[model samples]
Target: MDQQTIINSLPLHLRPFVKQQRYDDYTPRDQAVWRFVMKHLSRQLADSAHPIYKEGLERTGIALDHIPSIDEMNACLARLGWRAVVVDGFIPPAIFMEFQALKVLVIAVDMRSVDQIFYTPAPDILHESAGHAPFIVDIDYAEFLQRFGEIGMKAIASHADLEQYEAIRELSILKGCPQSSRQEIETAEEKLAKLCNTEQAPSEAALLTRLHWWTVEYGLVGDCEDYRIFGAGLLSSLGESQHCMDDTAVRKLPLTVDAVMSPYDITREQPQLFVTKSCKHLSQVLEEFAASMCFYRGGTESLRTAIAAQSVCSACYDSGVQVSGVFTEVLCDAVGNATYLRTTGPTQLAYRDREMLGHGVAHHADGFGSPIGHLKDFSRCLSEYTIDELKAHAIEIGQPTKLEYLSGITVEGTLQEVFRQDHRNLILSFSDCGVTDLHGRVLFAPEWGTYDLAVGSAICSVYGGVADKESLQLFKPTPRTSTLRVDVDPSLMACYSLVDRLRQQPAGLDADDGSIEDALLAALAQYPNEWLLRVEMLAVADSNLQQRLLEELRQLGTANKATEQLVAMALGDFPAPHEDRPASA
Candidate 1:
């Protein structure tokens, strides 16, 4: 399947986030970066990573030599029951999860700069494709990833979380760009720091992201003492992959629902990693955590979470009716079960995820309020009462009716309408109504206009977001900010292009061509400080020139410990070294 066909198949709402991969946008240097990262990451992870990783890379459509194209990848992904779509860096987590739930991988379009070659702060194409898509070949891991999306998308998030998402997204984009100034980064950091302190408590979505960060992003697999690399954050990263292996610096713990309790810092290396017993164990731990979320655990327990979010949420009553709005208050009974709930803004009444007729945000534009317990003498729910039975009891429409609740609340009004669905009363509207507690504190007065009391016996469930998704766009995913492009000198680009030409040769080309060798030597002379060029040149250079390139690399490595480590690692494990290092370090 082609990218366009796969994209056309997506939900209309998600297609806006999908972008075209301008394969032409990648420069020769960019391809070199991809090759370098994949080459070393693969060799380093051969034994350390999950065994399927190498096979997965092949099964999925990633190539070791250059950046993988979407067309080839989508074709390969389709065979594994998945598809790939390119997105701009760092889409909203909920949106990302939604795509995953649909079994479509959200591949970020931006490639990391060579400057941040080890690891980039943003969700670049390298991380999204090389880090994530490789594991899609494994059925168990794929199912776990898809299931995570299904649950995570429903997780309730606070309005403040939206602000934080934009902040973090901005920081990642700026930091990933080589040309971004230190002052600009500091400003973004300050804003993100302020948002961090603003969160009084982690919302359901916030907590779920912790689990995702720990597992999908940076998780390990197997026992704490003996684990393999499965996390994309580790697999795509060269530095963290090695840093995490040091037992003294990075602690390893058994995977559990408790991982959610410890939040992660995306810009910094994690201090700890969670290890699952197996891929199946990942889903088990996920279920354990999910079972505790508001969407799964309903009633007053869930309502409080929604109320605290201070954003659009929904509460399902025992009568099967759901009210969605920015929840403000929840009156409780002696045992703390919700007795009466009130929403202070536009609220919609929905049943089975569909809006109820005559009751929507427009009708209740001001707000909504209703009781949520059984009637004083009723052995069953008020909604369950028959129309004839209600009329016999003097609660008929168009007549004066008064009712008492078990919670010491009373309703007196001229019943104007009884809204029923499948013979079950969903709402009872009244004119000239007066609702009050035993203490005579009026909940609703006659002057307030018609009162539409939701006819439910009790609160059954409460979760985040509107029950009817089509009701309102309460939250929008933060769209991606463009990654910056730092221009390189033409001569330097020419040199990179020449190296790329050598790399793509049917049979490995030696630097025996005088003009090619002169250009290589001129590049080495003009950009003497560059080490990656030397590394790239070392691969295609014959024995005679390899000695000269190795000498240059050694000199470059000596200036800094980082370069030293890179050259040492790249030369030792780069898989294309044609010459042996000198006996002297």
Candidate 2:
């Protein structure tokens, strides 16, 4: 399929989060940050990262010297059955997974600032494109990513999940913006920390996301004791990648379903990492977790899970009809089998992931409710009954119909319609129907409008979100906020622009003359702490200027260990930072 065709096929709800890359928005300094991180990361990762990392970079069209645009990535990714879209900051996790399930990668729209060249807490182009896209060259890993998305979208989430996601997202946004105050970042950090420590039980979605964090975000390949870097988190962060392999600081655990028990914090470096045996093994562990999710094992338990979540979800009946809405209550019998279930507001009925004719949310805007078990005399689910069989039960259009269930739920009305698909009756509509439970409690009043009964014996599967996502937009898309653009003084940008221009034209620098070095020194005198600019100046500076640049860098290096290491790294002395641990890492 063509790239646009594949991307357009993504669900309607996900499109709102997608934004234009606006390639021109990247400032000259932004370009410098991308080059600095990519050049250094590629060099160090050349030895420790997976072999696929190097080859994938070429195939994926991730440029080491420039911030790659969405169109550029799409051209290359389309060849591998993938496409790229730009998104601002953090999007909802569920929406992100949905995009992935369609084989579309969402590249963050912003680049990290020069100060955050080592690591940025927020989602950036560096983390999403350079960190992730390269690995898609491996077919096995690509499949795993899609499968992860498939399973992730269906996993049941808790009420706190969105709140927690928003907290972390806020923190990342605050940290990424260069103008953000210390107090703002600290407040966001406190809020996220509190949410992390909440006493509420973890939901299936939360646990499954934990597994995603371990394997896809920060995973290693090989044995627990020894491994190569593959996860995007480590692959993107210069400091984390260097320090992560350390045994004393970050414990390496063997990848398994149990990895879900270990939650991750986005604000801090992980104290531990999981190592899978291979790329294929990543999916194996994921499937193990998938097998345990409510979407796979549905019944009264899954219904209860949906009720606890208090969000939009889908429950598939054995008869192949699906009810999608916020589950409010479930009525069970003496032995604990669900007798009837109800959804509160705006529900939809779907079959095979498509909205049924005249059974969308508009038709059932108030809510939807139905009996859960087989009828008294019918050994088969009512949906399985043929037209002739229903005639035997005196259930024909415009005829009086009375249905009794084993759970004492009764429906009495004149049959209005029977919606069928693939030779199965998916829904039965009745006029002036009065539904009553065993205690004579009216489930549905006769005065109400047409009663649409979903046909099924019991819920066979339950999952997050509406079944017909393309037809039903259940959640509101978070408003897109543009990532922080560098709007600094023009003079400051002039220096960065100079360095950026120097990179594009290497021949501009002449060792025979010290003009370029003198120009850079004049620029540096204004911005005293622009260490990266100094490091960039090192490449083309003559011996006299190179010595001067080193001396200045050495003085700036004393300000902090990160600076010290960067200057040392530029000089190639002591391998700069700790490959095992950056200072205080």
Query: Per-prediction TM-score, please?
Result: 0.90, 0.93
* Candidate 2 runs further than 4 Å off: 1-9, 480-482, 511-518, 560-562, 573-585
Q: Which residue pairs show backbone clashes in model 1?
A: none
Tens-digit lDDT track for model 1 on 277-395?
98899999999988888777777878788888887888888799999998898878778878788899799998888788878888999889998888987889998889999987789
Candidate 2: residue pairs that collide: none
RMSD of each candidate? 3.5, 4.8
Candidate 1 lowest-lDDT run of ten: 471-480
Deviation (Å) of 453 in candidate 1: 3.0
Candidate lDDT (C-alpha), each:
0.85, 0.84
- Shift in Å, residue 147, candidate 2: 0.8
Q: What would you estimate as the lDDT of candidate 1?
A: 0.85
